[model samples]
Target: MKKAVAVILLAFALTGCGEPKIDGSSEQAFQTSMQKVRDSLAEDKRAAFNDAIQVIAFSQVSMKELMQAGSGDEGGRALIDKKIKGALAGKTGEEVIDYAHKIKQERAANQ
Candidate 1:
């Protein structure tokens, strides 16, 4: 699972770093989005992630699977990160379950 996440984050980071000037707003958005994900998990969903380390909380599935399930486009990292933001802002519980379910389903599909 961690391997899958590393691959996804690698692909995500590589795709974004293609240019010399990185967009500052997007980076800020990612930071905010990541924080929201951590906070939401810590506050309402204990099963999702650890709030202290600011990393993925769920150990059962890879983030790639969750993004695939949530966005269904294999979207870019920023886009997927935004989706998670949306989950945290609007539909916290449902989105988390959706992410988890989709992660498992996607992972199984690949295996």
Candidate 2:
């Protein structure tokens, strides 16, 4: 689940700037759209979403680099975008965040 979130985050970060060849939305619009998605999520999910955003915000990764990685690589980027969207389809934000938290708790217990 962590891996899934990481992938989604990476993909989202990569695709956020709106690849000219792959995405039609502008960067501002893409951010707005993502915010809307987060807003639509339930409270718990919103918290998790906020946490994820914070992580991304604090990370040293350069969004410009991420965007460059996605550009000129339509196939990989498009596939990841599609898969992440499909995997998240119909899932409530709360459920996704709860699952992630559950996994974290179990991992901590095991350790």
Candidate 3:
């Protein structure tokens, strides 16, 4: 019974672990990640986890813009999604947003 239970639990956990969430918007994505972290982790870790998720979601916006720029190209959009999801891995939301802002500043200065 224990072995069966453990196998089932492991399989279920693995399913969610490998996939990255692609949210429609940064805010929505962060909210979803925060909720998941809040539900699964201790209270003390929720804030940090939430911050990390926020960064991913924020950075994810760049992907959306890129996809939109290549609008109607399904292949291009799919590629953008994959790249953004991978980039969001193990990052803080604040860190992502701050980096984005810095890039924007550099672009503006160059202009």
Off by over 4 Å in 2: 1-37, 40-45, 52-71, 102-111
Q: State the lDDT of candidate 1 residue by residue for 1-111, as single tens digits.
A: 999999999999898553122122465754565455555453555454333122223443367766665775655544555544444443343354555566567768999
Give the alpha carbon lDDT tens digit for every residue of 1-111 in model 3: 999999999999888674233343565674576354355555675566556555444545576666674778777666665666566544444444445556557768999
By lDDT, the candidates rank as 3, 2, 1
Per-prediction tally of clashes: 1, 0, 2
What is the RMSD of candidate 2? Answer: 16.0
Q: Which ten residues in a row have the lowest lDDT in candidate 2?
A: 18-27
TM-score of 1: 0.31
Q: Model 1 off-target regions past 4 Å?
A: 1-25, 42-47, 50-97
Worst 10 residues of 1 by lDDT: 49-58
Q: What does candidate 2's lDDT look like per residue over 25-111, in tens digits?
A: 444554555566677766666667666444423232355544754686666555444444433343344544554556567758999
Among the numbered candidates, top lDDT falls to 3
RMSD of each: 19.1, 16.0, 8.8
Poorest 10 consecutive residues of model 3 by lDDT?
18-27
